[model samples]
Target: MKINFQGAEIHYSIAGEGEATVMLHGFLESSEIWEEFLPEFSRYGKIITVDLPGHGRSGCLDEIHSMDLMAEVVLEVMKTTGVKKANFIGHSMGGYVGLAFLEKHPGMLQDFMLLNSTPQADSEEKKEIRDRSVELVKRNKPAYVTMAINNLLSPKNTGKFSEEIEILKERALKFPTRGITAALEGMKIRTNKTEVLKSFSGNKILVAGRQDPLVNIKELKQLAEESGCGFISFSGGHLSYIENKVQFIKLCISSKK
Candidate 1:
């Protein structure tokens, strides 16, 4: 269903019933990305899937949708749905927003998991890449999205998941230039929340992709260790939910147990 938040329409869906489990999709993706895992996850609890502002059916809130702002949007959804507290699973950019949420509303998180994501902020190099992405989005959003989705998957699995990749690209094409650039700017300025994860007294999990081009596996593993969170690795790229679905789901279930 859609809710008005700060003059923007936010889209979200909740299914099954039990403790709450919120799933936030990454950049360029909508709540639909979590569809395959919803049935299984819902069996455990009420699973919520949300379309972050500027993506999917959600409307943009501003020129830059900061992680803090996005987290507030998620909080609004939970409050509206009568969820006092919930476990959170975030993918890529979604994870960044989760960190922001953790910092802003620590008591609200029963547990948290980062899928193909990290707690670290963008490095100088990554920030430059994001800056470039903003420019690319303005010049050619389709090409930028295509290149991004292709690179997110391991080169070895690209052919295997070619159809899926195309579909993702199509979905990404729906993003307006303003939204795309806004996300890039927001991600570029996000603060490092490794300490937030470390101090969290609740259960946390970090699932890293060994072949992920976007994340530094070694760094993420170190962060997981330092934070005393469970660490799991998969032999795939950033899209481990698709590349290694079984193990991913198993880890998710086990994390909550």
Candidate 2:
């Protein structure tokens, strides 16, 4: 469904019932990425999945687009859906948004989960890569999406999760070139949320992949230690949820309780 917010339509999927639980997908992904385990999450409460602006079927804004803006878009979805407070589960860029949401709107989160994501800003090297991705997407869209998927998976998990990666690639290939540029720009300007995560004194969980290159286990361990949140590791790459849905849901359920 579309939630109208500040003249932008936010696309969201609502499933099951009871308390609310929101799921935010990573960059180049839509809420549909959670289809496989929506039923599982729904068993605990209503499961909400959202497509951040410039992704999936959501509309974009010409205003200052940042991770905080994305979180506000999500907040609007919650208000419109009558979800006073909900547990949040975020992946990659979505994790940044989750931290942003906590910083800006702490009262709305009952519990938060960071899955295969981190609070640190990209390094100078990583920032350069993001800049290049924007340029490449504008010049050759398919190659940009293809290369992105290639970099996201670890070599060992590549062959094992190739089919899942292809599914995500399809989602990326469908993105608007201009939207991808906007996303990269948003990523570049996002504030380093390490402090936000550290200062957040609330119920939270840290979930990491054993083989995730982007946010290594060491980084997640540090976050867990610094923030005093429970941490769990699964066997997979960055896309742990795709490869280990059972363990992911189990950890989420256990952490919240």
Local distance difference test values of all predictions, in order: 0.92, 0.83
lDDT of 2 by residue, 141-197 (tens): 999889887777767878888888898899888877776788788877888777777
TM-score of every candidate relative to the true structure: 0.98, 0.94
Scanning candidate 1 in windows of ten residues, the lowest lDDT window is 248-257
Off by over 4 Å in 2: 255-257
Residue-level lDDT tens digits of model 1 in 139-197: 99888999889899988998998988898899989877788888889999999999999
Model 2, position 193: C-alpha lDDT score: 78
Our model 2 lands, by Cα RMSD against the true structure, at: 1.6
Q: Candidate 1: deviation at residue 215, Å?
A: 0.6
